[model samples]
Target: MMKIGIVGATGFVGNRATEVFLAQGHEVRPVVRSASSADRLTIKNLDYQIASAFDQSQLADAFKGCDVVIHSILGSPGLIRGSVEPTYKAAQKAGVRRIIYLSSMIVHRSAPAIGTTEASPLVEKQQFPAHPAKIYAERKLLKLREKGSVEVVIFRPGIVFGPRSRWVSDLASQLSQGTAYFINEGQGICNSVYIDNLIHGIQLGISTPSADGEAFFVGDRERVTWFDFYRPFAEAFGVDPAQIPSLPIPEFHHSRKRELISAVTNSQFVQKFLASVPEDFKQNLKNIVPKRNKSSVAVIPQVEEVKQVEHKPTPVVNEMMAELQQSQYKLPFDKAERILGYEPIVSFDEGCRLSIDWLSQLKQFETILKK
Candidate 1:
C-alpha cells in the first residue's frame, strides 16, 4: 500500500480525501496545525503531522518518504499563488513522488460559461481576480513535474454540494426559512459537483497513470436550470415551488445599497429611516417606468405556519440557503468520467434528503436538551 500525506486534511475536501484513502487501505498521514483538528481524524487511523503550510522545515519532515502528497490547502488568491511554489519545492526536496491539487472551475471558465462545458475563447480572456492566482498555482506544480521527478495532477471542481457542504447546508437552511432571492429572473446557469464525486476524482488522480501532468474538470453529467434545480428542494420542504418569488435585479440592488448605507452611517435613526421605507420601493419605482419585463411580484407569505419555521433560522444563514434553494448549480460530469473515471455517488435529491435528515436529528437533540 502507498504511504500518502495530506496537507490541509482538516478542511472539507481534505476530510473526504482522508476517508477515501483510508478506505482503500493506504497508510495516511494528515498534516495539521493543531492537535484538536488532528483529533477529529482519529476514526481514520491516520498519522498526524503538526505543521503550517508556510513552515518548510516542518513540511519537509512531514513529506519525507511519502509516496504521494495531496495538497488541499485553501487560501485567498494572493496566498494561493505565493504559497504553492514553496510547497512544491519542499515536496521535491523531501522525495515525494506524486501530488494532487484541488482548484475551482472558476480558474478556467468565464462567468457566463460557468455552467456550460462548451469552451469559449472568452474564457481565455476573462479577468476574474481568482483565476490568475489559480493559474499560477497550476503552473508551479507543472514546472516541478517538468524539472523534477514528482508527478502532478490537478482537479478543478465546480461549486461543490453534499451533506455538511456549504452549498447543501445553505440550500436546506433557506428552504426551512422563507427569504431566498434569485438574480435576474434566476436565469443564470450554474455547474455543481457533489463532494463524493470530487473525492472519487481525487482517488483516480492518485491511482491512474493517465492523470499525471494533466488538468481535468470534475462535475455532474446533467445540466440544470435554476427553477428546475430548486423545484425539488421546495418539494422536499413540503412547500409549493410557485410560492417562491424571483426578485427583480434593480430591487435587489436597491435593498443591498440601503443595507450598506445603514452599516456605514452607524446611526440607529438612519437605520430605522431606511427600514421604515416601503420594503418594495424599488419594485414600485420600476413599475412607473414600464421598461423591460414587468417584474414578478414578491411572493407574499400565504400562511403563518411557514413563516414561524423560517423565522427560527439565523437570518444570514437562512438567506444564503434560500438563494441556493432557488439557484441552478450543476456540472459537466461526462469529461470527468471519461478521463478520470469520476462519477457522482450522491444525486441532488439524495443530498437534499441527507440535509433534511440531519435537520430532523438536530431538532430532536434540541428538544432533548430542553428537558
Candidate 2:
C-alpha cells in the first residue's frame, strides 16, 4: 500500500478521497490546518499533520514521508499560486513521486462545443470568477511536470453534486423556502459527475501510468437533464417542480454606475464613513420622501430615472447563467477512457440512490432546515 499525503483532508472532496484511499488499505496522512480537523476522519492508527497549504514549512513537513500527495485545497484565484506553487516545491524537496491536482469542467465555458478535450482552451475572459484561478493552477503545475522532479496529474470533474455539496444543500434550502426554479424551464443537460464517480477517477489516476502529464475529464455515463436531476431531489423533499415558479431568462446587464458606487462604498476608505452615519439620519430620508399614498412614497427624480434604465428581471440567471442554461455542454471522457481505462463504476442512477440515502442522514439538511 502506498503512503498518501492528502492536502485539505477535511473538505468535501478531500475527506471522501481520504476515506476511499484508506478503505483500500493505503497509508493515509491527512494534512489539515489543525489537529481537531483530523477528528473528522474515522480511521484510527493513521498519521495526521497540522499544516496549511499556504505555509511552505508546514507543507514540507507534512509531505516529507509521502509517496504521493493530492492538492485539494479550494480557494480563490489570488490564493491559488500561494498554495499550489509551495506544494509543488515542497513535494520536490520531499521526494514525492506524483501529485494529483483537482480541477473542474468549469475551466471551460458552460456551453463548450461537443467533444471538448483537456487540450481545449480555457474560458479565459469568462466572468465566472473561479475559472481564471483554476486555469492558472493547472498551467503552473503542468510547468512543474516539465521539470521532471514530480509527475503531476490533473483531474477535472463536472458539476460535482452529492451530500456536502452546495448544489444539494442549497437546493434543499430553496425547496423548503418554495424558491426553487429553473431558467428556461430547465431543458439544458447537466454535466453532473457524482462524488463517488469522481473518487473512482482519482483511483484510476493514482495507478495509471498514462495519466501522468495528461489531463482527464470525468462524468456520469447517464445523459441526465437539469429537470431530470432536480425532479428526484424535489420529490424526495416533497416538493413539486411544476409548482415552483420559473423566472425569465435574464438579460445581461452590469450597471457601471451601480458597480462604481458599490465599489466606492465598500472600499476601506468609505467603510468607517458609512458606518458612522446615524441610523436615524438614514431613516429620516426615507420618511421625508412625500407619502403620496399609504403604499406609495415619492422617489427622487434621479432615482426614478435610474430605475427606468435598470431593467432587472425576476432572476433565473445573470448573463453567465443564461449562457449556461441556453445550451448543452456534454463533456466526453473518451481520452480518460482510452488512456486510464477509467469507467464510471457507479452509474448516475445508483449514485443518486446512494446520495439520497446520505442526504436523509446528513446533519447539513437538519442545519439548513433549521435556518
Candidate 3:
C-alpha cells in the first residue's frame, strides 16, 4: 500500500503526515503549494499535488508515481535552503523510492552536551536562528545522499508537540494572551516529540530497510521538562506553573530591524517590497499605528476588568523562547530505537491526554476565553 508523496502538505508536519499516511492504508499524495494549500487538507479523496516547494519542474510534476517522498518542508531560511536541492532533484525526477527528510533536533544547539547523539558535532554556531538552517538542510540532504541517487532518510524531530501545534496552539495562545513565559525555572530538557510520536517516526522511516542513508533521533519517550512541557498547558488554562515567570536566558542584539528583515528575506527585495504595497496603502499603515489613543479626551464606557499583561517576548520571540528553554539534554531516541525500529507510541501521560483533547476539540478553550 505504499504510494505516499507528502512534500509539505499544509504544514504542522505536513498536515500530520497526511493524516498518518492516510490512516496507515497508504497511497496518500499531498504535495501542495496552492489551491489554498490544497484547501488545508482535512483529507478527502486526496491524490493531491500542486507543487512549488522551490519547484524542480514543479517538484517533478508533484512527485509522480511516488513510492515515498515525504520532505516535510516548512519555510524560511530562504524556504528551508531553497527547498533542499529542489527536493532532491525532485526526488530524482520522480522515480522516488525514499525521501523522508523532516530534520531538527535543532541541529544540536538548543542545548546538548551530556552525550549528544546522531553522531554529534553539529551546532555550527547557533543561538537557534533556525540552527544554521537545520544545518544547511542536513548538509544538503547528506550531500544528496552521496549521489547513490534517491533514498535518504533523516528524521531529527524534537519539540514537535501535538494538537495542531505551534507547540499546542502557541501555548494556548500564550495562555489566552497573558503572554506566557519561562526560561530558566521551567527547567530545560523538553526534547518533546508527540505529533503522534512524529508520525510514529514516519512509520519507522517507511518500513526501515537499514533505514536507507540513516540519520535518526526522533524523541519523547520521556525525561520531559520545561515544567514537564508546561504541565498540560497549565492544566488546560487554570494556569499556575508556579505563576509562570522566569526570564534570565537571553542575549541577542543587532537589529537594524532584524538586519532589514534578514536582508529583505534573502531577497528579491521581499517580493518587490510586497509588490510595492497598496491595499489601501496597507490599510493606511494599519490606521497609522497607535493601537489605542485617539485622545481628544473622551469619557469612559466603564466596566474594567480584563488584565493579564506582563507579556515580554519579541526579540525574535525572545530568541525562540529562550532557545527552547535551554534544553541541556534528553535528545536520545536511541538512534531511533536502533535504526528505525523506533518506539514512542505516545505517552507523556498519553501525550498530554491527546494534547488536552485537541484543546477541547478546537473550541480552543472557548476561543481563547473569547479573547
Candidate 4:
C-alpha cells in the first residue's frame, strides 16, 4: 500500500481524496491542525498528525514516511507564501518522491480568454485573490525541478460542484424568499468539474511518470450550460427553473468603473482621500450614475421586480465566468488525456444524480446540526 500524506485532509476536496486513497487500500495520513480534526473523519485505515503546513518542521515530520505528498490545502492568497511554499520545502526535506498540487483554472485565464489551455498565459494582472497566489505557487514548484528530486505535478480544475459545494449546500435556504435570477442572464457557461471526475484526474497525474514537471487542466468531457447546471439545483431547492428571472450582466464601462473604484477604495490612501469627500457630493454622484448593486447582479434577479444589490461588480470574477453559454472558456484538457490517460469517469447526469442524493441527506444532517 502506498503511504499517502494529505494536507487539509478534512475539507471538501481533501475529504474525497482521503476516501479515494483509503478505498484503494493505501495507508493514508492526514496532516491536520488539531488532533480533534480526525474525529470528523468517518473512515478507518488512517492515521493523523497535528501539523500546519506553515510549520516546515512538523510538515517534514508528517511527510517523512509517505511515498508521496498531495498538497490539497485551499486557503486565502496569503497561504501561497505562508503554507504552499513551506510545504514544498518540507516535502523536499522529507525526501518525498512526488508532489501533486491542487491548482485552479485561473492560472491559465489571467483575464478570461476564450479556449483556455495549459499553455494559456498565467494571469498577468493577478486580478482575483487566488490568481496571483496560485501562479506564484506554481512558479515556485516548477522551479523545484532544477533544484530538487521531487516530482512536481500540478492539475488545475474548473469550478468544482457537488453536494458539499456551497452552490447547493444551502441553496434551498438561499432561494427560499422567492427571489432568483439567472446569473448573467444565462450567458455564462458552467465549467463544472464533478468532484469524482476531478479525483480521477488526480489519480492519473499521480501515477503517470510523464506528468512530472508539467501542468494540466482536468474537467468534464462535455460542456454543460449554466442554465442546465442551475436548473437541477433549482428543482432540488423547490424553485421552478422557468420562473427564475435573469440577472443583469453589467456593461463593460460600468463594470470597469466599479472595479477601479473598488480597487482604489480598498487602499488606505484612497480610502482616506475618499473619506474626505463631501457626503453631498458623493450622493449627487450616486444620483447621476446610479450605481448597480452587485448583489442583484450576482444572484438571480429577484423575480419580475428588480432591486439593486449593494456590492460592487467583481470584474475579475466575472472574467472567470464564461461569456458564451456554450463556447466561452471551453478549457482544453488535451494534455491530460495525452499524458495521463484522463477523461471524466462521471457523466453530467450521473454526477448530478449522485449530488442530489447527497444533498438530500445533507439537508437532514444540517437540520441535526441546527438542533
Candidate 5:
C-alpha cells in the first residue's frame, strides 16, 4: 500500500478520496488550507496537515513521506491557476512519485461537440471563468512534466455527482424550495461521472504507468440526458420532473447588465473604497439609489403554460443551468478505458439511489418538506 496526500480534502471529491483510499488499506494524508478546513473531514484516526495552498514549502512539508499526491483544489481563477505549479513542485520536494490533478470537461466548453475527445481543441474563451482557468492550469502541468522528476496524470471528468455533490445536495435543496429549473425542456446531454467512478479513475492514474503525462476524460458509460439526470432526483422528493418548470435557452447578452455590476462590485479597488467610506455616507448612498422590488418578476424567460416558480435562481445560477441544460453531447472516456483499464463500477440508477439514500440519512427530505 502506498501513502497518498490529498490536497483540498475538505471538498466533495477530496473528502471522498481520503475515505476511499484509507478503506483500501492505503496510508492517507489530508492536506487542508486551514485548521477549520481540517475539521470538515473527520474520518477516525486520520490527521490532516494545514498549509496555504499557494505555498510550495508548506505543501512540501504536508506531503512529506507520501508516495503520491492528489491535487483537487477548487476556488477562484486566481487560486486555481496559482496552486498548480506549487503543488507539483511540492510533490517533487516531498519525494512523491506521481501527482494526479483533477480537471473538468468544462475546459472544452460546457457543450462540446459529439465525439469530442481528449485531443479536441479547447475553447479559446468560455462563459464560465473556471473553464479557461482549468485550461491554463492543465497546460502548466504539462509543461512541468518535461522536468521528468515527477509523473503527472490529469483526469477530466464531466458533472461529477453523487453523495454530498452540489448536483445532488444543492439540487435537493432547490427542489425542496420549489426553485429548481431546466432549460430546453431538459433535452441536453448530461455528461455525468459518479463520484465513485471518478475516485476509481484516480486509482487507475496511480497504478497505470502508461497514464503518466497523459490527460484522460473519465465519465459514466451511460448516454443519459439532463432529463434522465434530474428525473430520479425529482422522484425522490415526490415531485414530477415534468412539473419542475422550464426556462428558455438564454442568449449570452441577456445577462450582461448583471454581470457588469457584479464585476464592478467585486473589484478589489471598489471593495477598498467601500471600506474607507464612512458608514453614514455609504448608507446615504444606498438610500439615494433606487431599491429594486424584493419580489420582482423573474429575470429569465419562463414557460407561460407552467405555473410560475415561487423562487427563481439567481442570474449566475440561471445562466449556468441554461448552459448545462443546453448541452448536446457527451465526452467519451474511451482513452481512460484503453490506458488506465477504467470502467464505471456504479451505474446511473445505482448512483442516484445511493445519493438519495445519503440525503435520507441526513433527513433532508423530512427537514426540507417540514419547512
Candidate 6:
C-alpha cells in the first residue's frame, strides 16, 4: 500500500480523500491544523499530523517520508499568488515524490453553450478572480514536474456534490422547505461531479501512468440545466415536481436589487424586508449565476401558457408550497457510473429520508426542551 500524506485532511474534499485512501488499504497520514479538528477524522488504521499548510516547516515535517502527497487546500481566486508556491517548495523540501491537486473546471476556457474543459481558452484568460489563481497553481505544479521526476496530476472538477456538502445540503434544505428559485429561466448548463466519483477519479490519477504531469476534467458526462438538476431533488424528497415554480429572471433580478437597496438604506429594516421575502431567495441566488459564456442570453421558457400565470402569492411561490407539501428531496447519481467508475452508495432519496428523519428527531427534542 502507498504511504499517502493528505494535506487539509479535515476539509470536505480532503476528508473524502482520506476515506478513499484508507479504504484502499493505503497508510494515510492526515495533516490537520488543530488537534480538535483531528478528532473529526475517525478513520481506523490512519495516522494524524497537526500542521498548518501555510507553515512551511510544519508542512515539510508532515510530508516527510510520504510516497505521494495530495494537496487538497481550499483557496479563493488567485491561489497561485496565495499558497501554491509555498506548498510546492514545502513538498520538494520534504522529499515528496508526487502531488495531486484538486482544482476547479472554471479555470478552463468554456464554450458558449458548454462548460469549460482542459483545452478551453479559459486557461489563458485572467478575468475571473478564481481562474487566474487555479491556472497559476496548475502551471507551477507542471513546472515542478518538469524540473525533477516529481509527478503532478491536476484534477479539475465542477460543482462537486454529495452528503454533508455545503451546496448539496443547502440545495436539499431549500427544496425540502419549498423555497428554491431559478435564475434567468435556469437554462445555464453546468457540469456536476459527485464527491464519491471525484474520489475515484483521484485514485485513477494516482494509478494511471498517462495522468502524470497532466490535467484531466473530472465530471459527469451528463450536463443539465440548473432547473433540471433541482427537479430530481424535488422528486427524491417525495414532493410534487410540478409544484415547484419557476421565477421569471427579470423578477428575480428586481428582488435582488430591492434586497441590496434595503441593506444599504436601512440596516434595521433590512432584516424585516428580508424576512418578508421568500426564505430560499438568498440561497437560490447564491447557487444560480448567468451563463458565463453567453452572459447576455436569457433562458426563454418553453411554455407560453405558463408564462401568463399571475405573479401574486406568485404562481412560483404556490408551486413551491405545493411541491413541499407533497414531496421530499431526491439526490441524483449518474456521473459516477459513466465517468468515474463509481456510483454514490448513498442516493439522494436516501439522503432526503435521513435528513427529514433527523430533522423530525430534532423537532421532537425541541418539544421536550420547551417542557
lDDT of 5 by residue, 1-371 (tens): 99999998989999999999998999999997655557789584476897777778899999999999999988766667778888889988889999999998888878887778899888867777677889989999889989758899999888999988989988888887778777777889999999999999999999999999999998888998988998998887888999877766655564788867755664434543453455557678999999989767665566556466665454234767777778898888889989999999999999998888888877657654321
For candidate 3, the per-residue lDDT at 27 reads 82
* 220-287: candidate 3 lDDT, tens digit per residue: 77798888788777867778778777767656787678767775675433533443454456668898
Note the residue pairs that clash in candidate 3: none
RMSD of each: 13.0, 9.2, 19.7, 10.5, 7.4, 13.7
The candidate that wins on lDDT is 5
Model 1 worst lDDT window (10 residues): 308-317
Two-way lDDT contest, 2 vs 4, winner: 2
Question: Could you give me the TM-score of model 1 versus the true structure?
Answer: 0.70
Candidate 4 residues lying further than 4 Å off, grouped into runs, are 177-179, 250-327, 364-371
Report the error of model 3 at residue 107, Å: 15
Candidate order (lDDT)? 5, 3, 2, 4, 1, 6
lDDT of each: 0.66, 0.76, 0.77, 0.72, 0.84, 0.61
Overlapping backbone residue pairs in candidate 3 total 0
lDDT of 4 by residue, 269-318 (tens): 45334534555677789899977775444446557766665553222324
Per-model TM against the reference = 0.70, 0.79, 0.32, 0.76, 0.84, 0.65
Compute the lDDT for candidate 5: 0.84
Give the per-residue lDDT of model 6 (tens digit) for 1-371. Answer: 79898887877888888887888899899987666668777574457887655556777888888888888877444323345555677788888777889877656532222333355454555333456667777887788677766688887776666655665666656765567665434455545566776787788777766667767666554545566566655565666556665565232223667745643543323433442444356657867965467434456778554344433333343332222222221222333233444443444334434434444344322232111
Candidate 4 all-Cα RMSD: 10.5
Which segments of candidate 5 are over 4 A away from where they belong? Answer: 252-317, 367-371
